[model samples]
Target: MKRFWMAVTLLLTAGVLGACSNLGFNDSSESTASSGTKTATYQTTGTVDSGMYQGVIKNGRYQTSKTRGLATSTNTQSGTYNIKSMENGLLDLAKKQFSTSKYVFQEGQLITEATAENWLGRKSKDNANGLNPASNGKLDEDTRAPIYLQTLLEQDFMTQSGSKLQLGGIAIALGMNEYDYYQKVKYGATYTTHISDAKLVSEGESMAAEIVARLRRLSGVGKNVPILVTLYKNAGSDALVGGTFFRSVLSTSGSDLGKWSTIDQQNETLPTVNNAKPLDSNVSTDFSDFSEQIENFFPTLAGVTAQAHYQDGSLAGLNISINTQFYSETEIMSFTQYVATTAQKYLPDGAKIEITIASTAGTQALITREAGAKGFYTHVFGSY
Candidate 1:
């Protein structure tokens, strides 16, 4: 098809040039390109040199030679296509006879304005940025352009890092490579990717390797990546984020294709909280941490009978929290222990916490962690 366009464009160029030179055209670069003929007159100024007829811009039309060699142009029509029912099957808007198309951008080597506008899940506008422009992106696993751009968009969408775009939808990736095809779904505005392949080969030279490499780059966003996940959608994709295409790097795993050489990468990313935007949301907004507020609700003035080992009077204290629904002594003791355990995930070495239940008011139970390390972890508990 590209060759066909090239040929057609060449013929058009010949016709245009032939018409221009026949009217006793004797001037060089300074020649006027009147639309009609010698009877018409007009002029404009650019790099006008009477000696420079290098065909770079001769007869007021860009030439297909020199710095721009054999450039071709083919007009593919485009128009705002209202959502016609999909019952007729996916329409091929690239062909004029298929549907009324529109011009996207003829300024470069390729013009997919029609596809950019009306592809399955794309915005009617946005053939700019040289980005995919479509809601979904180009996914040629074998090529770096599509996958890298997809990774960029995915990162932005996950962190809501840049201007956010869209949410869960069924989308397709258009590309020209081995990771050339697949479906991606946008759920919770995060992306989950799945693959449909005849074989999942993790061998060094196989297509699976390229796919894994691309995914690893995308997953570098870590837990900051949003989790717009869905086990199933009508589009048959497991997940999506901001509509960028993502194929599970794990596709190379579970069989001869297992591990995908990403076990180390995936291991690092698995523990990051993607679905919960903890940092993006309000600090006190209760979410997946419901089990940490019991002690604050009841102020219990209780005594502890444990070994308060303070080595050489160092700054050490016990951290406590009540873990009981009734806020009883047993619960207070549990709270004390829980805080100490939770502290391990956030304290400095050798620092300690001493937990004490003060008292229980009407509906409030007070728990305290008498630790010198408390100040160091104030931000963490204060957010609680």
Candidate 2:
């Protein structure tokens, strides 16, 4: 089929050039072209001394050509296309197609209109930047140029090298990729695609790899690199901050024939809180001496207990509880300030320090380490 198309295009080119030449439409000349119904006026705008602007009009379209060596040639088509409209149409078509396809996204339970919209927005942003002129600044993905280029390239390849486009194959490949990305990020399931689906050569390489690579290439924002979706969560809260579903493509080695790497880069961090949790046993031993020193610094204080939280083998935060009797709120606050300043010297680097002072006067003072300061900052209100 590719060979057939190439032959047809070559013959058409030869016929067009012959007809133009016979009609005295050569270098530095102008002529009117007609295709039964559609006609266009094309004018060459270069000197006869140089082979420039060698073009012809047909079917209301103007086209130019340049030939270097016998095997080297180039062609350019001149016409106007509505990029904004084309992108919008393609995005809408893709959304509709995916909504009904096997790759439909299920939100929390089942796919609803709201879920569909969310999925579309997510996938589009993951693939493109999610630009929509129709909506208020943001609507859907702007896919006009890539799709347009793909169409033109498909035609040119068919005309030049007898290669046909695998429209169905491309669609299937992209669908599979999206399905895998969603499954892993949303459902915590992991899988891989084998490279040995088939062994066909296109342009002296594995056609399967070529197709997959191109699909990934088109699924990116710029330079047709690749798109990766990543999700993040933590043990602290049921809320997750990053279901944004976009990341960088690491390497081509992870994406080749017979091998598709797993996407497992989810990260979790302890949420920052005023109250401190239990310290790791190894880190807990260092605080005993410090607690004694804090008690000695304030002989009037009844008792003191310190809890240090560790993150990745380093101190993350510190919370000190002070027990006292008859101390006024101001006196309790002053005690917390003393502890804040004294603890900073002994606490691990980068540890957030908080001091809670409880007194028999039915008043409590909660002081936090001041930002960009070495002293107590402000009171934080919360249950002890």
Candidate 3:
């Protein structure tokens, strides 16, 4: 465990969502998909969000509370895989770089390229676009990619109780997101790939509720549990990489993603030794020009004040009332400040800011959801 954390930090010092598959929200482009430039339609299916996606993490802990009296659990995860999207030309260039390397997850262990191709790698024309050099924008976890943090839970992360694993290690999934800006004129949409770990255990609703009660005591909640979203572009080969702002969604499931279907809508082609581009760090998300959006903007949360009876038959359990309080803020500015000084792990370069207010109990404010809102409505953060 110590070695894993150390390795991640070192590699991270060096550099480094939603709902699909076990990971959630996969944009698998099928054979029927259109060209890299052609516009397309999508459909979706999976778990209904129901605000469960609006989570807040404090000191690296996520306090999860179910809508109704249901099972409570915790999850953590870490793993590695690359989802590259580019133009046909750039993908060809990148393939050469991957030749000597078979996409290693760590020091010397080489994962099967065929396995990666079927699961994480591209196999079709659309999937190939993932490695193409024509990409005008970076991948967006909110859109093109599925939130596989949960998907990889079984392998990447282990469960303590929810779904017990007798031999695997603790699963802890981390969410690091990046947004793209160049599409249409520059390209089309977003692209993404990730690594995660998960550890989950099921508990009585009463116990789950009890945990939620303890979380209420945190001061300045929103200050600690904030999310960052970025807009990056010009990531493709020199021929087509231009500039533009892009948008996507961070969700648990695409089951009800309006008309957005996650399966088989992506460019499935991949880069080979003969066709690939050099992988480089493009735009930085933690820039002063970007902004963030928050969902639950609570000022201070003492926790859910409720009566415990049915949630758990245990007399020791207390009833918790989920008195829903709403806050909206353009927290981009303040959040960026915190990330610059404290969150060196994610926002080492620093990010922009937007003000968002969702809820307030006292000095502690709770932020439910936050993301990078770039476009005509880009600067608009928080729920107004």
Judging by lDDT against the true structure, name the best candidate. Answer: 2
List residue ranges in candidate 3 displaced over 4 A: 1-112, 118-159, 162-246, 250-254, 258-384
Model 3 TM-score, 2 decimals: 0.16
The lDDT per prediction is 0.23, 0.30, 0.20
Candidate 2 lDDT by residue in tens digits, 325-372:
745555555666666666666555456776677766543767677323
Cα RMSD of predicted structure 2: 25.3
Estimate candidate 3's alpha-carbon lDDT, on a 0 to 1 scale: 0.20
Question: TM-scores of the models, in the given order?
Answer: 0.18, 0.26, 0.16
lDDT of 1 by residue, 1-384 (tens): 000000011101111111221223222222333222121231112233322111222255532322122222211101001011110111211111111111110111111222222221212343232222232333333321221111110101100112211111111112211132232332223222333322212211243333233333431223221221111111212211111111322232221323322111000111124553322122112211322333353464222221112222332232333222343555545554545454443333453443333444322233334334343222112112
Model 1 / residue 150 / CA error / Å = 6.9
Off by over 4 Å in 2: 1-282, 294-307, 321-327, 359-363, 370-384
Backbone collision count in every prediction? 42, 3, 133
lDDT pick, better of 2 and 3: 2
lDDT (0-100) at residue 147 of candidate 1? 18
